[model samples]
Target: MQFLLDSADRQRLSLDARPDGALTLVFDEATGEQASVAPRTLLWYKLACTLPAKLPPAIVRDYATKTFKPAQAYGALLNTLGPCR
Candidate 1:
């Protein structure tokens, strides 16, 4: 998976996910402002991006049939982004 985020600050960030389980995030090319997160961390990043959609309790219960919404899982998901790297 890949995506481009154009910030209001006029910055273009290129994000790429590879089949080999690696995610590359590039901020700039001239100054080499870039970083790459491990495959697992990348997965968490993807989940975090969609967290808002699962924030509603009704939606969570309807789809997952779980009483609790996953919004509370945000912290644990975010924590996975670190240490695992």
Candidate 2:
């Protein structure tokens, strides 16, 4: 999936999901910077973008109910981490 990271210049960031269950983040062009993002963070960011309020309620419900397995698993993992400080 590709996301626009910068709106002014239309800089894009891509998330490539490999067949072996790995994810790679790619930039549209060389930016001469180093960056790292956790998988869960990326997942939430994607959800935030795709499930915006401007979308129809039915679409949002379908995405949250049918396509939210990753978020659900992340939630379960967070539960095992105990309460936040």
- Model 1, span 1-85: residue lDDT tens: 4546565589887765565555567788688787876545654455445433324566445644255434444333344343332
The superposed Cα distance between candidate 2 and the true structure at residue 12, in angstroms, equals: 2.1
Residue pairs in candidate 2 whose N, alpha carbon or C atoms collide under 3 angstroms: none
Write the residue-wise lDDT of candidate 2 on 1-85 in tens digits.
2223333457566544433434445654576332333444654455334432343456445656554654444444333322322
Error of 2 at 60 (Å): 20
At residue 57, give the lDDT of candidate 2.
Answer: 55
* C-alpha lDDT (0 to 100) for residue 39 of candidate 1: 45
| Structural similarity to truth (TM-score) of each candidate | 0.40, 0.30
Q: Count clashing residue pairs per candidate.
A: 0, 0
